[model samples]
Target: MPSRADPLWRHRPPALLWGLAALAVAVLLALNLGALGAVYRRAGPAAAVFGPADWAALRFTLLQATLSALISVALAIPVARALARRRFAGRRALVVLTGAPFILPTLVAVSGLLAVFGRGGLANQALGWAGLPTVSIYGLQGVLLAHVFFNLPLATRLILQGWSRVPAEHLRLAASLGFGRRAMWRHIEGPMLTRVVPGALAVVFLICLTSFAVALTLGGGPRATTLELAIYQAFLFDFDLGRAALLALVQAGLGIAALLALAGFTLPGMAMTGLDRDAPAAPGGMARLLDGIAIALVAAFLLLPLAMIVLRGAPHLAGLPASVWMATLQSLKVAALSVVLLAVFTAALALAAVWSRRAAPLLEGVGMSALVASPMVIGTGLFIMAFPFIAPARLALPVTALVNAAMALPFALRAVLPALHRAEADYARLSASLGLGVGAHLRLVLWPRLRRPAGFALGLGAALSMGDLGVIVLFAQTGGETLPMQLQRLMGAYRTQDAAGAALLLLVLSLAAFTLLERLIGGKEPRHAGT
Candidate 1:
């Protein structure tokens, strides 16, 4: 407190970081708001709030999202409970695998779903052999199925994290009291579920609401279109800029309303604290039987599609088209660029949030905006703003990378902020007393402490960028296709084998990138100054 000789900003550089972060967010918002302004200005009295088609799309979007959220949460309960209490041979492996779907490319997942549920797919083949009618997975049913496939594992993991928070002493006390399965669930699991389930449901619902790739591929026709898909159709197909802008605004409004309504029910923090330890509980025959069944069913549901993709795609790998390879290279470039952008933005924002008292809340809010801002809205908004000067098609890759980085910033921040905060808390005074300047402090103190989480965040960004198809759709034309876009094209051309092969390649690349970054940079253990 008495050190007048200290550099003014040596303790923290919040202003600089805040300016950088705020500028990025402002650009995104300006693009969206600018598009809305252009639409209203150009359309004059012709602008609308909703057309009949829009109403239909809204209804379908809400219906599918609600169903997907409910089903994912309800089904996750039993599976999460089983995972919480049981120690099995592959328990850790199962938990790790649960995170796969979250990073898995959407088109790859859609292809896998199609392989297991389409007309000539395994399920339909089995039904035909049994002289039963085959079910169609081409409408709302297909969309729900795909959403559940993507979200169930996520729900289970989130709820499992909730379970992990239960104090070990309480479990020991329950075991000492000879609490049966019913009593255990009544007092323990039920309370945890009450606290976690609503937030889980809300998050899943919001995710499904903005779903584009699933609806685009499996949503049969106009009947199953979501609001995001509707915006795409309006702009790309009908060339209706006014309608697209109105839909983007509507989608944004819906997302904002949902965010406000669910703001109180904050999702459980996803940070891995390395605090989980086995809790004592009485094992019973019935409990074990039920847990086994729950685990088996969930495993089958999650794994079968991936298995089908591997089996079906293997034979076609050698015959993959040259376009697929080109798209793969393009996808890698986009993902690498996105990771770099995301890392810079997230690091700056995280530092600001930790160091600035007044700006923390505002910076955090901007980061969280990525969660509610539909990719379509941002893509359409930017498209409108760019259309006046340069062709949007030429800027497709860069724009896609930028938007992907923005979309991924929230997750990256989640990974980095906690570690950064810890590092600052532990070493801020030490560095200040040592007269370490900002750059030296960051390089000597923060970098080592932040490496693990930074790597994890970067890995997440890369995987997500690799899989993203939403913005690319609005921008990219024939020669500029990403891997996801290429997969969609193969599917459109009825080249199922090639599409499956491409899907497999995309999946492998995304996962491998994630794994390599997490392993190589982060290592296996959490490193701290004292430790």
Candidate 2:
């Protein structure tokens, strides 16, 4: 049933795509299962013994993740609704700024939070002036604050997409029919919320489940430890492979459960489109005032911590030690390697999924399977497997780059597949008719079409890798430190000025890498992708 408008290319899965898919899946399986198997082999009977501390860690992990998701989604609802219903100067800029947290390095963000909410920070200073009790930005409350800071904007953007999808005609009809606010909620917005909110909740929950750097930074003590942090303590302090492997399994199980909950729901993309226009039936008076307040509050919440980091860091930039500079060089190298790996893996998987309908689901699943395995688990397994071969510390940069790329693949693929599909739909047949081989077709057609999304994906990977403090901690030796690790060291040593300067330097470099790569290859405008 090829129509006149349809391209005349044969409708079959390309061998090249399948081969690439198979290769990618094999590597993924080998990395994940191999690591898990290594851990399992190392575990003893002690692995089965769940101590009081272990149970408490599990409870705290679940508690923090659940609260973070609920609070982030709850806060997002009002903000997203406000954004969807109102239009003002700088509206699009505000929306674009919402994406900043996704790329913001976790530890840098924690430093900002400390500057604003810590004992001597702004919140405490204000409270002291007002004769009020100061709040502590540590333990469970700090963790919640940080998670909400990272996720609320993401949840808002996702829900805003739901609002964007509500047809303009439907809003017009509701207006003509004189639907009240409650009626509009009942008939229109309610259903959209039901469809979108669960997925957003699930995605955020999954992310928080694997959180290590946040818990590592703000987790006050054993009472506040998450499963990932527990794994770290077990391996580093106790040198107990059995306990570490057991904790890794438990952490992996939690992640899998979250992923399963995400099943049957379409994973939302982070593309910022169709969200800038004013609502057709926007209310005035009180509604307008409320919307303004909501926007102003959310904007302040997002921007203040970042402002604090810059203000504090700017003064110490010239005084940073040589170690900080050295770490910056190492981080840049890792980020570059990570971006290269991400491009290769993402392109292969996305192309396979695009050209092979029969294997699309499998291909997509393999690309995202890294989500089921936490970085600590993967790092531990790699450490164990490599212990017999060479010193794990020597392999830190390469392994960090590899793990970062694997973690970033799902987001990269999500951005690339749509563009690939469009290219196939619009030009596949014409390219075939021209008898161009794969190289010619790719260079002339696919590269031009894929450049923007691919650049954005690579840029995102580079930024995330640049700020990463996860696996490197486990493998870092005397001299093998990345910028995030260096910052952590500065903070641990109570070098406040140096830490602030390093945090600022990390932030600037991360944002610069993201913008440079995205603009250099993606051209003027670039759309973001989600985790």
Candidate 3:
């Protein structure tokens, strides 16, 4: 138990760290809010651009995001249920694969989907073989499909988590009451999802709202220009910075309002930090064939396209320029820098959170609210914000790394805050008496006790930065590309073979780099560092 006279702030590092993170996020918000001014200045008046075309885009955007969110959540249910209850061969690996979409490059997934579903895609070819009509993947519907592909796994993970949280005691109580599956669901699962789905839906809705590459590539007509895509068009194609800035401002506001509202629902007990904790035990038999079929279909949905990524691309990488090798090195460099920046930033903020009660709440609030600002929105804002002073953004990989690291801040806090709080609860008084300074204390005290979280936090930050799209989209040019960016350009130019090779290269490198980092850190520490 924590001793008294511990004066909540007496030796509080976690709270202090969190408070600083809150401030960082607040500063970020101010920057985006400034984008609002940029919008009004550039677009003339709201009345000017709020005409029919704008209204149409708004309606279409809402429609697409809603459909995407619904599809994502609906499809997640059975898959999540299967994941929660069953443990078969390769089950763990499958669950991990589901998480791939969250971190996978947008272009890679789009390319794989094209391989499987495009005009000359495997799906169309299969249909030809069967003498069935081939479906077109070029419209609002196609955008929804891509969003669902990316978000379903996350939603499933979230719902299944809710399912897992139904305490075993609750299950035992239901069993003793002779509650069958339906009744059990009524008493337990229903309530959990009634709580979970609202937040999940809101989150998916927000993510789909700001999507760029997906909407740009698949949203075939003017009917589906997302705000992010609009910003790209104004800035990149038209050189209309004024119009782009206005759209960007509106996008930022939309993101903040939606995210803050959603965050309100998810603040306490909604750990949805994208961590895939194993489900607690729940028994299910082969009573419903549909359940089994649902699981198989989901597994297929999760696996088949990803397999295509590796199989289709493995052979084409041999002919690429040495520049590809340089890009890979550049990716490592950016990831390394971003990971360090994130560690320092998250550590400081987390300490603030622990030290100051007000600070913790504020950071949590900001982090939660960040869900609304997709990497695309933030990256656009940052680029627009940075460009006048920092010309040639491609060379500013350091800046890109900094922004990406900051973007990953919320997740780092999530991974570290809990562990830090636990450590403080366990050792506050002792540390206060010892009066250890930062270096000595970190070396002897916190590092030993909290190494797992530290390692995990560092790994997560690195992985997020490694897979990040925001900075790359805004900063990278044709002359320089991360594997993800190159993959995108390849697909955009219809070099599907090369795109596949790039995706394969990205997956292998990202996994290997992160694994090596995790291992190296673990080796460096020797005792408590995590795998």
Candidate 4:
């Protein structure tokens, strides 16, 4: 995919700026790894990793992630098929709404899920009228329920993107072969599942494996703590970097092994398959009933929390004051700044992807850094590390922007890099003769070619920043607050009314901005897998 005018164009200055920058950031951040070798001081011995408590936490983390991934993917299949095949009104809206969680902060999402599924939730209240027993929404089941709530739609989008990729020729073949529902699935759907399942499962598993937010809020007792939560406890509660470093190593090792195993089966060619789309044949009564149930189940999981946010926030809308509006403006500024930072950083990552063989792993390693030491862990560590030389909170906005941008690098890479490579492949010569500078090239040549991907990347960046917690958690002790931090503050103070109102406002703004950015940046994506 290298081209004549692109940095890879050989007609050019190095297009490797992004790679160089990424490597620099990696080297800078990789400083944390040095902590591991600082003599485990009190670790007792290398074999001491199997502490009963640590072992239990590890066991429970694996159990929760495996169950969550299995359930999330299993539920996603039917939902994906319906979305891919059906063209009903609101279907597009539903598809977009499936991405809603990507923009919602984890803590905010926890609050919303608690509203609908917690003991005092709508379900219990309604069921109470029928004399049903109240359900507890804290523990392993609670963690998985929240996981499904957050991930099911995203999993659907990923798979449905694949399902929609089934080629037109394949549809023609299905018709010629007199393929019924069962036959169609065997021939077409099975292949789509094969392609989508591992990535979906691995992504969900990776997330759940290091799950800190869901576990912190909903994991009822010590028994349910995840590796991420344990890391937090070791650092904050125990002040033991020796233990934290060891746990971080253990987490990194497990995650790396899982990812490498998955890497062998995945290819660029394979990734595009399920999006080879086809118009499915209409089903009769049985299929309709099944589709309805599937749709309802998935929608319930995705929408109930959103509904709760709106319902809880609605009552306080009439009484909010001037400071709230000021806070909202501050959030917007942060969102805009965060989006710019994310765009630049993601562009660097995308450029890196185009230029080097090693780009993928470097970016992958950096992307997961946020997981190893989450907001509290990273924020706390950076705070400690910077204390002697400089004040960490003084750089809150920039740090928040940096951490947020780093976290979003992988998503942005996924969106922008592929199209950038394609565009370079398609138009290298013409661009070279035109002699465009990078800025002008972006305005005229690059933007048009990669408009869709840029929009997707930008939206993802903005959404992530808007809902960010990583740096903001520790940094924003100053008067200003990003939307997520403000929401967290409201929760901490038990100002539920104010938090609800703010959550509603933030939910709408973040989702709307993300959608707008996506629309603006969105260009034509390939319609079918084979296309």
Candidate 5:
């Protein structure tokens, strides 16, 4: 507080920073509010009202999201606890593997699940051998399976973070008092869970609520439709713009309601002071056996589907159709463009947020606005706005990239802003003393620090755009298909072999894009001698 020359004391932001921030806000507003305006304009009086079908979609949306969240959290609790207390060979690798599902292409993961669980899959083969009735994977059960597969890792990681934050001293004290497992839970672990579980549940709920590709592929029957599927039906199939607009608004309401619910919880980012020491172990062979079983089961559950995908798709890879190749190219293009847009927009917003005190809140808010707006809502508005002047088909890839970038911006900003702040804190005085210009400072000082987070953010954006099946489904024409759309088309045509190959292709591309971008842009730091 006494320092006069602190970086925080710089009150006057540059004009360029203001301009970039304004542009970022403008883009968000155009995508969100502009879309809302178009939706309102097209929603004709009385004709746009909700009916029984719409209500059913709403009910199904809420029910599935709630169930998915609950089940994911329930399963995650044991897996996370196992990881926290147990030390074993390959444990670090196992923990790292938990992040795979988050960046994994959604449709690719779905295809893997299907390869293992579908009608003629290994599960049914085993069931038939056991003289039991085979299970169906085409309705609500399929949707739940897919959701749990995708979200279990996320919940596990979040809960594991809470475990990391717990005080090691508490465990030692409990051991000194000879507290049994039940007593230990009553005092320590249970209270930590109370703080962590709600946030994890809310996040998973929100993610499942806006699910499009999963519901589209697994649960699209009349009884299983989500609000997103309903919106797609209204807009594309029925050509009822009014109904689509109304449904878009309803989807927006659901998102807002979920956000409101989330506000009551203590998010996992909060910190607790802890002794910097290893946690004391509770002694029991039974407990060790249980923890080992938990880890093994969860690992098998996650990895088997991926293994099935590889086993099933390898031979078919050589025989994929030319259309699938074209779609792959389009997806790559979209992912590239999306990474660029996300980088530029995120950099602008992060710089503005760091450099300008007055605009920080508004800029951050604009960055995160995509959370409240569904892709379908933004796509619908863009469709309406362009219908008069341009064909929606022509703008398909560009619009997809833009919306993907916007959707990814908040996450990118989260990575970048902290890095930027750290850079400024560490180097501001040195750079000023050396009389370094803005460009030089950025190149020599800021770039090195920002590179890692920015690369990760770009990689994440690229992966997401590479595998997106949402807005592209709405706008793609027959010839202009992205990889995900083409894969869905293959599935629809009952070309299971081709679909499996294409899914494998998409998975490879998604993982490759993330790894290459992160490694290339976030270059490895060289180690110094005499450490």
Candidate 6:
């Protein structure tokens, strides 16, 4: 047993390690705020204020995000209910597949979207065959479509988790009462949606509000511009740091406001249980036909673009340029470093929050701030900070990795904190009663219990890092390209086949990294004493 004053105090609960972790987070925040402040001081108050153009961008951002949120949630309800009530072949696999888009790189998803929805793409071709007017996917409609594409599955998964929470006894009682679908929904599912939908809507809206690459690629014109895209244009294209800083401030304000608006609708924990248990199946009839159609349509909608990417890119895989390969290596390195950083940051903060009940919310709040702190905003601030001190372009890889870690921190924290809390609640007393030291308890108890969620967080962080394009765009120079940036260059140069191949490669890599990390870390379940 170690004394309170032991040299291993650093490993104990309520240790200074948590403080150090908090300090590191503070420094990261400070550097960005400091840069923003410096820009404000230099630019003056007038430069930071919004103009008519800026207001237009703000309006577009809100409108698209709002529409996207509503449509995603609306479409998700049937799909989620279908998934919840019906356990068919590959249903579990489909549930897992739903998570793929959330981690799929923005640019990669955009490429796939364009292949399916762009002018002269499959949808238009089909419409032409039908003698129907063609639709375009290069404006506000396109932006909203892409947002729904990415977020619909996420909304489904979240709502499906809520469905899983409907108490089995309550459901059984409904069945005993001869309740039909309408009654079940009225008494059981409707209330669950009331609890789940607002938070889901708010989350999806905030994510879309920070849209950058999707808008950049498909925005098509000024009318489609988002605040994030404006920030990128202000800094990269116009070299106007002051305007970029101002826009970043405005973006932050909107994000904070949106968060405050949604703050009352608490997000359900990501940790899921009892999924293996079967619920009372909804009676088969027209309901089954509707559910089947809903499931089929969603599967097609979610999977067709991916199929197109694969079909188109398969022929071009061998022709990928050396530059693309090099960029892939660079991306892997960045993602690896990002996973390490994110793991340390998330674990420390989560543990610290669990240890200090009074400061838990504040500590967790700091972690969640990454959600609203747009990557481009952070990158712009860091670029401004690094400009005078070093060649900002030279530090692109490291800065990108750091910003990627920061960007993924919020999700990682969400995945981890709940699991940590549950593990602590379940095992804390048992370990303490056994006189296990902090280090021993963590290694023997907490680590085993936490492996699943930790792996999930790490996988998500790695995938997001690998796919990130925001900060890298601000700092990348010759020879410093990431895979996403490299793919963008390929597309710019009319290397369509090559870009498609690279998109396929990136998609495969991102999914593989996420799958491998999650499985490898989340290994086989542990056996308990009796079992």
Q: In TM-score terms, which candidate is top?
A: 6
- The backbone clash count of each candidate, in order, is 0, 0, 25, 17, 0, 0
Taking all chains together, the TM-score of candidate 4 against the true structure is 0.86
Model 1, span 1-531: residue lDDT tens: 637444335355747776886776675566456546765565557756687889999999889989999999999999998888898798888877766888899989888888889898889999999999999999999999999999998899779979877877678778999887789879877777877888788878888988999998899998999998987887778878778778777777777777776776764543323334456754768888999999988888788888888888888988998999989998998998998888778877788778775878888877777666767767776777788999999999899999899888877887888888778778877777788888888899998888888888889889999999998988888888999999988989988889889988988999998988887778787544532
Error of 4 at 20 (Å): 6.1
Judged by TM-score relative to the true structure, which candidate is superior, 3 or 4?
A: 4
**Candidate 6 C-alpha lDDT tens digits along 228-318:** 9998887778767678787878788887887887776665543433334345667788989999999999888888888888898999989
Q: Give lDDT for model 6.
A: 0.83
Candidate 3 lDDT, 379-441, residue by residue in tens = 555565566777746545876687667666766676688877877677766665676555565
lDDT string for model 4 (176-207, tens) is 77888889878777767777788888878776
What residue runs in model 2 are displaced by over 4 Å at the alpha carbon? 1-16, 44-47, 265-281, 419-449, 526-531
Question: Each prediction's Cα lDDT score?
Answer: 0.83, 0.86, 0.70, 0.71, 0.84, 0.83
- Model 5, range 1-531, lDDT digits (tens) per residue? 524444432455567767877887998999988987887787656567789999999999889999999999999998999899988889988876666677778888888887778888788889999999999888789999999998999899889988877878788888999999899789888889988898889878878888888898899498899988888888778878788777777777777777677776665554566656777874669888898899998888788888887887899999999999999999998999999889889988888887776878889878877866778878988988898998899999999999999988867886788889888888977776676766677899999889988888999899888988888877889989999999988888989899989988988898899988988988875565522
Better of 1 and 3 by TM-score: 1
**Window of ten residues with lowest summed lDDT in model 4:** 34-43
Q: Once model 5 is optimally superposed onto the true structure by TM-score, how far is the C-alpha of residue 199 displaced, in angstroms? A: 1.8
Worst 10 residues of 6 by lDDT: 2-11
Instruction: State in Å the error of residue 490, model 5.
Output: 1.0
Q: Positional deviation of 112 in candidate 2, in angstroms?
A: 0.4
Query: What's model 2's TM-score?
Result: 0.91
RMSD of each: 3.3, 3.9, 4.8, 4.1, 3.1, 3.4
